[model samples]
Target: MATTQTFICFEQAASRTDRRKNRRGYLVALLASVLLLSACEVRLHANLEIEEDESGTIAVVMAFDDALASMAGPELGDGLGEMSAQLPSEWQAEPFAEDGFNGIRITVPFESLTELQDALTALTQGESGSDLPVGELMGFLGDIIPTREGDTFRFSLTMPAGMDQALGEELGPMPIEASMLDSVFDIRMSLTLPGEIVSHNADIKVGDTLVWNLSFADSVRTLQAESMLTSAISGALIWVALALAVLVALVVVLLVRNRRMRPMAHSEQVPEEG
Candidate 1:
């Protein structure tokens, strides 16, 4: 009976040891699985939009709309977040949108008003041949014209006499120049991510709504582009230099001509002969 009881005790101890070993193996496997999962790589998506306001100012707006929000907000945010992170030199963000129209508003100022006007003028040159209505011209050049406290200039657009339906519909309201973008403006982007249940990367898996506003201030204070100021100075200097050179040449020519044209006075000779 003693030997049998001893044998039973040894068997129980062996079973306990085996169970402990099995438990340790399971724990190691669980930890290894967790490490592998943590090492998993993730990929993000890309979607964007671009727009502009009046006043010949440009605005680039990028957003996912609603279709992309179905994926994951973190991924969308990460993808757009990279735009800020990567192109740090190109643009920056301010306190942007919280939801709905999510994105940034990038405003490019009109440093050279003349240049902007000229560009708009050129864009609408085609309209000169078309028989567009009178009101449309105001809409087209509204942004191009400059306004201040006292100064105001009104312009009328004259189109070719004949008119047609096709031309009217194709060309909507001439692009308006919005004064809102005079000093600074905004570009907005909206991104939406869909929600998911029981995701491993829960933070990145849920639907997210991100909207940011970006500003482009005229930091240089002056335009770097070829402007009327440079052109005017260059032209004035060239003409002035030409005028001076021409005047000097004219004076020299007149002096030489006078010397050649002057008749020599005959020397008064007292005749020594008498």
Candidate 2:
């Protein structure tokens, strides 16, 4: 499919439109999250929804405290603009920001797996776009990646390496004090893939969809293990694979049977005795 380039964007300081987040009413039953971090208090949430045609919507919401935000000021003061420039102009949508948190909303009218390949590469490298490190984009957004099997597609999101250190270097590491280990740094991610869910490692699973309610501490550990955040398989796809395997086997059997039967079936009758 032909694809026009696009990127994430937020509005100017003058226009802070309050676009309510997509409540996910249609997807509530389909999505759930299984991972959760015990102590971290910071939170970042990315919600992605895609259609069978590859067209979909992706939204990323990140929250940080003033102290930490100020520490990374030089690298990310521009905020949404940092992430917006990375996306193609076609997919640009206004971003929203509040006192301590920021949000980017984008509508992907149409897309192809090829485009997702770039997104995946960019995420792994921790770069939202050219020249901008994920550090500048707040790091949480780069964790998401896309995978495909047959006609079905799977996208998984997890914390990227160095992010913990980056934040630690800025905001400082989680204090040893037991009181500080809960929801201090949190990141929530959600998305629906193109197939029936085969299996997943998330904290919650509602149908084939995934909603991740996780804390920074949990995500950091999960990232270290590189555990699967979410996975899905189209129910129809399972049958398709089985059907193809069966068809191929049948073809081979038929060919072998024809070879074995040909000589005997065509053998001339021995009339000499008669």
Candidate 3:
């Protein structure tokens, strides 16, 4: 009887362990599904506009398709509200609904390039004290850091490696096939600088804006753009040119005055001699 009781207790424990494992597996699968859905059903657009002083505004819009909105239900609104609440007090977040899509728009204004870089880094790394899963998922996209060299501003984005491996390690295998990612997952980014765009490897150029369309089809992607800003040296040279023009004009006026006086003096001398 004692042996039988021990066996029964062991079986119960084993059953409980199995149940726990099943629950864990379900949660993991759910998380993976959410991520996959976000990738496929969400569209992200980010634009950065910088002034001559390096002060800029970053506008980011994340829109969800009908499928994602339906799947998320009311939880979508709650999640967006939570994300807004978690952002820094200075950042602006607002609800956005347009062209059959609904989502949120966040506008971040920075007084310097450093602040802009920090904001981008925080969003990509999910270090902004937000529990939003999108932030974490954005970590795999890549990095955007703008640098200034005299009159030129350089921007480069390089996609990181090991994204699939990282996802696999965390969530086992990807629920969605890799081939579908290209069709469903796309992100558009645009940058506008204060001055002329000198050179860029962007997919599209519209006036002063350089646009890049990114997708998950490639393991690695690189984007680069260089723009020339109005430098102090250029301003100083302009001022110098104006000053030289003024000086030349004054010299010409003096020469004319001297010539007129010489002719008058000659006529006066002739009258005195007569």
Candidate 4:
């Protein structure tokens, strides 16, 4: 009888311990869900714009830092070699290999508003319907701009709000018109994306447009590069949270079982002493 009673006590204690462990794990899981729900997620936004002349020639105007212009042509003859450097290999097989893109160009790199203004003035004066550098002459004729030394450029484009959102995602092949705005050249654009449509925004030209079939593909590569770091950080946070939850549940189970055993052990000792 003593042996049977001892065995029954052990089984009951084990069952209670198991139930407590289950409860701890359930609570831990609930806490984990709450933590995850409370965590803030950073949104990744991409913006891209394309400017094309009336002749079906396209120039991709990127709003990124001016450092990228290093990959642009020196003066339209440095070949596709320079641009291919800044882009994915797929670009080589398309725009780089096409003839229309051969005519596409880069603008002077801009470091500040003053520099940008200088380049614009230079372009405007040079293309003065008379004497100007071939590069500036091209701008006067509403052709592509060269990638001059600079950080940013101002092109005239009448853009709508929808285009702004789409530009954030870098979605492509939108229509752009290069027209004259009195003395200024206006690069008017109209884009319709998955959700909305943007009608107008004056674009400031900075670098040369990447012409050719591969322009779109090159853009995707750039967009992917910009977003990769953010995505990785988000994924890591998710895993870390799950691991911490598991560790907390283990600690809770151990503490609960220890508390239950201590009381039973004290009671048994008292009986022996009596």
Could you say which candidate leads in lDDT? 3
Badly placed stretches (over 4 Å) of model 1 are 1-227, 261-274
TM-score, every prediction: 0.22, 0.45, 0.65, 0.22
Residue runs of model 2 more than 4 Å from their true location after superposition: 1-43, 63-91, 95-110, 117-143, 157-164, 168-184, 219-274
Clash count, one per candidate:
24, 30, 0, 36
Model 1 agreement with the true structure over 1-274: per-residue lDDT tens digits: 3322332233245553443333322322332233233332111111121112113342233332332333334554544464444332223333234344344333233444454454334322323311111112212232323321112212122222111211233222223122222111222223222221111211131233333222122221110111122344567789999999999999999999888666543333444565
TM accuracy, model 3:
0.65
Ranking by TM-score: 3, 2, 4, 1
Which should have the higher TM-score, number 3 or number 4? 3
Task: Name the runs in model 3 displaced over 4 angstroms.
Answer: 1-40, 140-142, 162-175, 230-274
**Model 4 error, position 4 (Å):** 99
When summed lDDT is taken over every stretch of 10 residues in candidate 4, the lowest stretch is 177-186
